[model samples]
Target: MAQQTASPDDSNGPESLYILGPFMFLGIVFFIVRIYTRLALSYKLNVSDYTNAVAVLAATITFGLFITAIVHGFGHHSFYITPEDSVIIFKCLYVVLTVGLFAAVFARISLACLCLQFTTSTVPKIILRAQIIFQIASLIATAVVTWIQCRPISAFWEAVPGGECFSPPQSWAFTATGIASDLVCAVIPILVISKLSRSLVERCLVCFLMAMSLFATAAGVLKIIYSYRFDRDPSDALRDMMPLFLWCRMEEVLLIIACEAPFLKSSIERVLRRMGLPVFQQKTKDLNSIHTFPDPRGSQGEAVKKDKGMKIDERKLEACEYTTSEDSTQSDESDGNSTRQQHGEVTDSSQSQPMSTPMDDV
Candidate 1:
């Protein structure tokens, strides 16, 4: 539970800052690491990286607005703040909410773009493309409605004697839309990634990262609940709305972190390996690499003849080592040989292709 204020002058301003500042810093740290990992692994930045960049930038701006609001008497009751400072708080909140909405939308788009790299099927691609369009459209409508809820616009943050305004349904609708989109973004990965031909461990890792959207959805739900509370007793708006502010910020930054988490796996593994920590050994071969086998049903002592090897495209094998380490083939060769022998066949390890996984784009 949030700490309650004892009087109009008593506020949770400092507590809110303490909570939000570290999260914003952590989100920026992940963004820098994501960029660094891609460049270090010899991979170029793609659409997903660029979209997440915009999301993080928007989140940074929203955090700044949050700080500005807090400093201008945002957490105090109406009576404790001067009219001028109250107006400034309202103005900061308006921009904060609007920019935060974009941050979430772009984060969803970035995740969708990352999902696109893992799939090549027509139906899944179409679904992902549709999701992107729906998110972009919703963002535009919500932003426009938010600003136009009051006839004079400035009435949102100040007292306008003759201004007309809409009811609170816009806020409710925005929250519902955010929650619904987040659920879809979270579910799409599970459905699509489960059907991938990768090892069970690898598929589960990617799906777990993608499913982190549920955390953002949970935050959105909390925001709505707190919003209802604020609506009922708006006399102390700054105090009552503190939870709403915190939950909204959480939803935005969590989505961004979720989008970047999968990309950071390689860097994390590298760090662990450098620290002499034991990571999960890849005991399976790269599905995208070529493997040759020899027919074991030959005459005794006859020279072994290799069967035709599966031809792999050279371009497809040029992925980052995070997806498939070149050293994995050498380590797992014995396991491969034993498996083939159980199936009454022999593999030619000398003809194995350089390790490269299909999920490198992830």
Candidate 2:
């Protein structure tokens, strides 16, 4: 097989790097925000948090793989690359892109885990589980079929191992499943948050968190739209796929940030405040909101009096979901108190209904 390193004159090489670099940077920033907020504010770690961490690890590996591919002559027109380099690029691309797809899968799992915190009924749980199972199955199927898409499996990167294969249709199937998975994951959270019993302001806060998924879904949609450009030019597969890989990496970044957004809202708000933004500081729970004073007559002539306000217990505020006071709630599970989290705001739930712990594996 022929072999050649990419030249400085190869515009495609630079273009591909530029496309992925920004997203890779933004994704790193979001990942940091998530880790800090969960540890500093929540003071507890959950399964979803661990999954996001793994996604970051996978992203880092994929980035290194991309660098290797570039060094091996990817991003050049087929004519500019040696047969040997083509084979190297093909092998690296197989692993790197596959890792990227699976990284996105873990990110999606993190989102689902966070969203699971909000579910109220058995049916929703079952549905969520089913969707997750289906997504995993489809993704695994895509990976396996792709690896074996051509018989004498080594045909993927080595033409010397020539064999007949039906990969185009299988590739399309993979893309379809990916899109379906993203759409379902994005839409379901919206539906769950929409059904919350909170006031419009509170509901909007949660909706905004869920909207991250919608934004990432849009990114995935863009990738699908541009996929045809790459699929149509097999002769220029390496060059054409550069744009596709760009979209793919961006989608990964968006999904990772979206998954982290729910947990990082408080930290972001604090950062804005430190930067001199006009932010509402959560303090002293409104006496009026917690509960109405008992009827005056019920006090048996010990006139029911309303205290203008009570200072917030710092410990409670700290224990509550990422808020400071009026916007937060803290409770002790042993006291049979329930906590309801609406994105960045978690308040002690008035009702003592049970809630499920995060199931990280999904």
Candidate 3:
């Protein structure tokens, strides 16, 4: 048995993956907390809501991979290429691809949930269904590609004594297909959102949701670029770990937050209002004042009629009081004949008289 030589491109050195691990773990924790809070507050937390479950599961898996990569990176000091090292690297790449595909599916589902909220028309419904079907097909394709990438799945991790693996180009092809599906999933939401009829505020909110898909797209692109670099030289350890694993983890974190943005926004608004912050006062005022008048012949007729008459009479009295108070204040201010206090008393009396009006039955 000969001592296997490490590849020349394998630069054994410290890398960014070690530093990214804990942060990715923290992101996973935060994602779980947010999801739990949301579920506790919601009417019923249904797994059938594919968006929520996918976001959560994707985050969990990504976090797990981040930890696995970190352990591998730290445990193996030599970033250089040994036959054993190549096995670990390829296994990590497999995990990265798996997490990326799951995250992409989750992102698409989240966007679909947003579309469902805004769209009621047949066309949008059909489009949404088509997107979902396409996503399912893409998932199946990616799964097949993943399994086929390594003929015997154990070859991906457990190195057979003399067994050969597929070339890097084959791996790259599978990766490229996964990335294409990711871009499709991300862009589809933006298209659906653009067709929706929404107020400026609502549109902005939906756009913000759609923008999250971009993170996943970027992750896919970064992974694709790095997959080529890794293929070119398997020994480029840092290149192999950082973009391939870190970006995918970051994408999962971002997707979780983005999917929960609407719930988070309302929670923040509620907290701010409780703290006496003037956030959304205008919107709140409009919402509070929106009311439908009762029909005269309905059960609410007596109360509605009384309210209407009282409103009219109060307005008339308020106008008369304002006129009298204005005249008295002007006279007092002009001649300097009346004491300021006495003039104020007269104005107050006139204004206060309206408060004493009787509200006997009509």
Candidate 4:
């Protein structure tokens, strides 16, 4: 990729900053809406559902803070010009690092929530526990790396005029850890959901939700790639890319919210209905009423009786038994009559036995 230099004038420029503001605003709104929806479904949902909501909230806050820091850093440059400007930039970088750490933690929790829905076996549970542990470790590592990225925290924002700063390796390690976590979270859902017992439609829906994790993975990759270039030149272009970083963070949080949307389908539909959208209302009502069974002995009893009568008659059983017995007796008598004739024929050879022969047979 070709490297583009970001002009100082572009820092907090009207256009770039303006566009990011609305997106950040919408992200905050979405996060609040998601929290409210989760609370509504809390009675029906499991612990994981609430956990996913919290994860999204954490990720949102992280991104929101990072965006604020970017705006602050860039906004400062809008009026002043000096090597000390790097100080403001580094402060923003610290905020980004802090947010990145939180984002990692939140992503892992969100993945755990997804895993809970599909897991039934002990092995999966163990794997989930391990993932959570690793996530915590990753968070701690990130925090430590960020703090050490700039020696003497005060030097991060105010130039000492001659002190040597640490290399970008610290930032690299932090970014690499986040990328690894994102990949883990993305792939874990595929494995877990694949083993779930669900209809094709249900499976597809879940797969789609799982697919949203790819956005996070993409963000991770972008962050890593951009971090590499930023490491080389840590310039204004890298700084302006803050919007992309904010987007990367926002994508993860939004995806977490999206994954949980199914749990709020009923509530969403209800809200839609109240707004006078008839189709959603009817569909939601229909789904809600599905478990209700009609009483056959009540209003539909006559219809049931009519259908049953068509397949069965009251006297058929009685007539069938009598006719079967009569047929059997007639068949026995015919056999007896034939045997008498045959005996008469045999008697002629045995010197004439009367045709009537006594009832006992000759």
For each candidate, give its TM-score against the true structure: 0.76, 0.70, 0.58, 0.59
Off by over 4 Å in 4: 1-8, 12-34, 44-89, 168-177, 187-199, 232-244, 247-264, 267-362
Structure candidate 3, residue pairs in collision: none
Local accuracy of candidate 1 as per-residue lDDT tens digits, 210-250: 88889889988988888777652356777678888988998
| Number of the predicted model whose TM-score against the real structure is largest | 1
How does each model score on lDDT?
0.74, 0.65, 0.51, 0.51
Regarding lDDT, does 1 or 3 come out ahead? Answer: 1
Off by over 4 Å in 3: 1-41, 47-51, 74-93, 158-162, 167-206, 236-241, 279-362
TM-score computed on alpha carbons, candidate 3:
0.58
Q: Compute the lDDT of residue 347 as modeled in candidate 4.
A: 11
Error of 4 at 176 (Å): 4.3
Evaluate model 2: give its lDDT.
Answer: 0.65
The lowest-lDDT stretch of 10 consecutive residues in candidate 2 is: 287-296
**Tens digits of lDDT, candidate 4, 245-316:** 654565555446444533444454466679986422111111110010133223222222433344433343
Least accurate stretch of 10 residues (summed lDDT) in model 1? 316-325
Task: Please write out the lDDT profile of model 2 over residues 1-362, one tens digit for every residue.
Answer: 13334333364767777777787787788788778777775677797788888888888888878878888877777677788898888888778767886888788777767676767677767766776676678668777877776687667677644576564565566666656666666666677766644445445665676667666677777777777655633666787777777777777777787777665556555677899975432223332213211232232222213546444443443333233244224334455544433433222434554332221111
